[model samples]
Target: MGVFSFDDEFTANVAPARLFKAFVLDADNLFPKIAPQAAKSAETVEGNGGPGTVKKLTFPDGKYVKQKLDAVDLDNLSYSHSLIEGDVLSAELEKISHQTKFVASPDGGAIIKVNTKFYTIGDAPINEEKAKEGKEKAVGLFKLVEGYLVANPDAYN
Candidate 1:
């Protein structure tokens, strides 16, 4: 098992609550609309859109990943989730964990942070390579969310 983590921070002019609502709460609807290249679509599986909810994201290559909400803190704008199941990368990944948090900066903007952990068996062909792939995907996601907030100032009401 290999452990890997990636962290990224983005300063968005949008409010924290607004950014959270669009990126985390309404991801099923908003992500596809903004980042069609990366996330073709998302569907809510278990719950509505809160803690314990399950969501599956479909990529363009016909592969999908399912995530189970582990924790949610609306006060701090943070949440954690683990990979329940997926064919994200060659079907060898057994477990993956990710957490996202939001902080309201003193400058009246919001900072978004993401961390990821991946685990695999012995000597997989793309162990570290897969981790790098995940980092790139995260960058793409941030760009899409940032672009959306930039375009729609009134999105999170």
Candidate 2:
């Protein structure tokens, strides 16, 4: 098996606490409502909205992914999850884990840092293009939430 990792950071004009509440905590409810074209819904399949919870995200095309929440720290504005099962994982990928951190910036916004680790099957090397695509999707979601918060200043406050 081969293991690969990628790190990415994006700055958003939203507070860390608010962003965490909207994007990390309430995403299952807010995402689909705000960007229905990208995600049909996100629902908790097992456990509550906490660590060890299983959440499934369904796309508009009917494809879905199941993720197991590993950790959540509202105080630190960080969360981690592992992809337990999903159509998003190709045949070459055996597992994928993600960690995200939202740090408060001096400007009252936040800096979102994401770390993704990909484990490949057998001798198959990790696909950089696919990894990049995943990162782009995350960025897109963040932007969508940021835009929503910008439009409604009182939201997630």
Candidate 3:
């Protein structure tokens, strides 16, 4: 198998703790509500949302992915998950792991850092186009969440 990894960072005008609560802890319920175009719904299919829990995210196009939670550190504002089953994985990927960290900024906002590792099928290289597309979607989701928080300052508090 081949593997490729990349990092992305985003700055938002939201507090780290609140953003972490909304984006990391409550994403299953918040993401779809905030960005219905990208995510139609999200549900926990197994476990209680901690490590080893499996969550499914359904998109507007009817495609879905099941991801297993690898780690979650609320105090550190970090989380990790691996895509275990999905149409996206059925193509050319063996698996994909994502780690995200949210740090407090001096301005009271937050800086979110994302690390993604793509594991490809045997002898096949990771698709850069797909990776780029995924990054775009992730950024869009973050922006949408940030906007929601900005508009509702009492949210996620």
TM-score of each: 0.83, 0.95, 0.95
Cα lDDT tens digits, model 2, 5-112, are: 888889999999999999988898898999998899888899987798998999999999999999998779999999979998989988799999999889999999
| Residue range 93-154, candidate 1, lDDT tens digits | 66787888988889987888878766665645446676778777876776678778878777
Worst 10 residues of 1 by lDDT: 119-128
Candidate 3 structure quality by residue, lDDT tens digits, 1-157? 8788898898999999999999888898898787888889998899997899998999999999999999999779999999989877856798999999999999999999999999888878777888888888888888899999999999999
The weakest ten consecutive residues by lDDT in model 2 span 126-135
Q: Tell me the number of clashing residue pairs for each predicted model.
A: 0, 0, 0
Query: CA shift at 147, candidate 1, in angstroms?
Result: 1.4
Point out where model 3 deviates above 4 Å.
none
lDDT of 3: 0.90
- lDDT comparison, 1 vs 3, better candidate: 3
Identify the runs in model 2 with alpha carbons over 4 angstroms from their true place: none
